[model samples]
Every structure is written in structure tokens, then in C-alpha cells.
Target: MSLTLYALGVAVLLSASFFYLFGYRSWRRRRVMAKPFPADWQTILDRDVWVYRHLPEPLQARLRPLIQVFLDEKRFYGCAGLTVTDTMRVTIAAEACLLILNLPLSFYDDLRAILVYPSAYRVPDIHREGEVLSESSGVHLGDSWQRGKVILSWEDVVAGAGHHQHGHNVAIHEFTHQLDQADGSADGAPMLRSSNALRTWSQVFSKAFDNLQKTLEQGHSELIDPYGATNPAEFFAVVTETFFERPRALHREHPALYRQLQQFFDLDPLSWTRAGD
Candidate 1:
């Protein structure tokens, strides 16, 4: 064989060896990202996700990479004859990825599967009444489980994205719960797990929670969703919805709370909004 041919053969062997040493998943991730993003996916994003279109160029660049990795790694299943399509997956994945766009974390490391429902799905509603437990069922648009699962309703997901100013995204709400669960518990604060800026976060969130409860008791609830008063965990999730969907409103109504979320996510969503909106 010619010397050039022998060198080429040796290079191929070395490349294969490197790929094996690094891990197949990482190798495949590089390969997956090397390709151009599908134009059809961009069209779906434009139509389905209002936030995606408004994101600043830099953040937009950061997001596509995360979306690609999320779609590649996370598993999705259809429930109730949902027939989860690329549009659904892309819409949900885009919203979820937005939360983690600039933050440091695995792409939803603990999340292994997403169960998509055609609409609101029924779940067992267990309530405790001061030493009494009542068993009932309720319908939810989406939920995140600490044990590697997330469930979402396709219709609600679209609705949530459609009403971007409402700050009521099912995908964003449930995914925020997953972020809260990162510290091994859902106490409405994920800063204990992923952020060093804890003092301000604790001070602001605690005060805000107290203020919300007091205000609600006084029969005045605006500026934020009253459902956030449920608990710290739900509060965390709910505020996240507001933070992304209604950033300007949240910033105007509760600047301190918005700063805390901004600190944690390491991204200022206000930049994604319009000049005056």
C-alpha cells in the first residue's frame, strides 16, 4: 500500500478510538448539531411560540443548541390518542429550553420521558383536611415529577403559548417545577441547588410570598396570579410562568421578585419583550 493510504487508515482508526473514548452519545450530539436546523421547525416555532420569535439574537442562538439537545435526549410518548407530532414536540421543547437557555445545568438531566395528552388529563386529587385525607381526581394541563417524568396536554400547551401575555404556560409551569425539584425537594426555591445568589432570593421570595398572602386575604389579587399563593413550590412555578410570559408586568408589579428570577436563570426576559410592552 502507498504511504498516504497507510496514514489515512491510521487516522481513521485514531478517530474511531477517540469517539469511543469520549462516549457515543456525545459523539452523536456533535453530529446531530452539525446539521442545519430544519426550516419547517423554524416555521412551527414562529407560529406556535410567540416568545421564540421575540427572543434577542444572542439568546436565540443559545436556544437552538439546547433545543436540539433536548429533542435528541428526552423521550416523548403520546397519551389519549394524542399522536405527538413534531410541531407539538418542538413547541413544548422550545418553551422548556427557554428556561434553561443561559443557566448551567444538564438539559433537564432527570427528565427522561414526556407523556403528551390530547387535552387536560385526569389525575388523582388527594387532599388532606387536618388529619383527614380525601381522595378525588382533578384535571391538570401539565405536571412534572421528580422521578424522571413530565406530563403535558397539547391543547393547553398551545393555549398557554398563544396567550403569551397571560403568563399561564402549562409547559413552562410544569417545567419550572422540575427546576424547583433539582435540589432533591420542591420547596419553591431552586436557588439552593443551582445558584450562589441565595441571600437576595430568599429575602425577596419570602417577603413576596408573605405579601401575596396578605394581599389575597385583603381581597386584592392582581399583578400576579393568585394560584402562586398555594405554596412556595407552586409559587416558584407560577412566578416562572409570569417571568417569561408577562415579564414586563411582573417587573412593573414586583421588581424585586423579577430580579430574583433574573438572577437565577441568568437571563433577563424583558429584553425579549417589545420596547414599550
Candidate 2:
């Protein structure tokens, strides 16, 4: 064959291979979503993930496939001799899936593993006491790592998941961190589509976060958790917990903040019926 013709044929073959390589991953995920959701898994979600019960019927249908794909693609490991069960997996996946129900993302594509402890676990953390910086282990209910991991206390998960009105879901809190840390450690803002969106988010979140910090410093804060005052990262996660678990209160208290979350999430959770503990 002519040398030029041979080179053209090789280029065509490489192009086809590239397309197939990427296309196959998308196809595999679709196949995972297509598998019929098991009855046992559905029951687990209904029982543990109270928020799952409140999703709009269409969204509920949309979320199940996401849960399936998450369980399929991500690895889950039990900690402290705890054995990860279907109830734990379904409950955790259900809440995390809600964060991406409307977004055109690959179901937390950067995340890979979820570590669940039976209860509160301790990890290396730092604390400043009396002007002294001390490095020590701190007991935490949950935390997210930018390097493709999330750690949770299953005990807290069950409590937070079952009480939708309390505005304290560890699953939602940690996953929001994952979203905020799209590019790196949680920086209070996720990747926005445009500079205008980023600017708007910055303005709205800054004002609201400032207000929250000031109010918390003065006295007992209600509706929005005081933990949001820790920093912008925690502010984003804490408010996300309030946004989903206590939408009415968040909207009534921080209207601008509520609207910002609504715009980014593309869902007005204000309509969902809040469950009583």
C-alpha cells in the first residue's frame, strides 16, 4: 500500500479506538442504571433514608438509578469491625444522590471510597487551646477528603437521615463538601458555569455567611446551624443540611442564601413536605 494511504488508515483506526474507549464507560454506567432495583434495597431506602420518601415521584424514580450506579462504581468499607450492610449503603447513597439528582454530572466522579464507622470516630485533627497549637485526634461524626474519600459514622447517619426536620444530616453535609471541593479542598463554592454565576454565588454566600457568623457570635442562633460559622467550607455544608432538611426555615431566615442554593441545585426543595421526628 502507498505510504500516505497506510498513514491515513492508521489515523482512522486510532480515532475509532478512542471513541470506543470513552463510549464503553458511558454504556456500562447506563447498563448499571437499567438493572431492576432490588426490592430489598428499596425497602432499605424507605426505612433509613426518610428524605427518600419525600422526593417528588419523578425524582424518586430518577434517584434509584443513581443509587445503583453509586453502589456499583464506589467501594464501601466498614470500620471499627463494623460490617457494612444494605441498610447503611442505601441510606448513605440515597442522600448523596439527591445532591446530583438534577446536575449532569457523573455521580461524584472524583470520589471512590466511603468509610463508615459504627459511631463517632477519631481522626488526626488540630486544636488551638490557650494560644497553644496542639495536634490531636478529634472525634467527628463525618468528614470528606478531597483525595477521593468520605468518612462517616453510621450511627450519626441513621439519626440524621431519619430526622429530616432537624437539619443535621451527615450524609448531605459531607457530600456538599465533595461538591464544594470539586477542584480541591472545600472552598465554599463549587464549580460554576459562568463568571456571572460565580460572582453572584460569591456575593450571596458572603453576605449570608457573614450574617450567620455575626448572629452566632452574639447569641444562640436558630434555624441555620451555628456550626456554619466555623468557616466558609463548613458554612456551605451546614447550610446545605439546612437547605434540604429545613427548607422552610432556611427560606424564611436566609432568603438570599436559600435562593442561591436553589439556583445551583436546580431544585426548590421548599415544596417537599418536611417529616416530623
**Top candidate by TM-score:** 2
Candidate 2 lDDT, tens digit per residue, 140-160? Answer: 999899888999999999998
The CA lDDT of each predicted structure is 0.85, 0.88
TM-scores of all predicted structures: 0.87, 0.89
Q: Report the CA-based lDDT of candidate 2 relative to the real structure.
A: 0.88
Q: TM-score of predicted model 2?
A: 0.89
Off by over 4 Å in 1: 1-25, 192-196
Model 1 C-alpha lDDT per residue in residues 1-277, reported as the tens digit of each score: 6999999999999998887755776777778777778898888888878888888878777778777888998999999887889998899889889899877545477888999999998999999999999999998888889898999999999998765887688999999888888768889878443345676687888899989899999999677789889998888898989998889988999999998888788888897787656
Error of 1 at 209 (Å): 0.5
Q: In model 2, which residue pairs have backbone atoms overlapping below 3 Å? A: none
For lDDT, the strongest prediction is 2
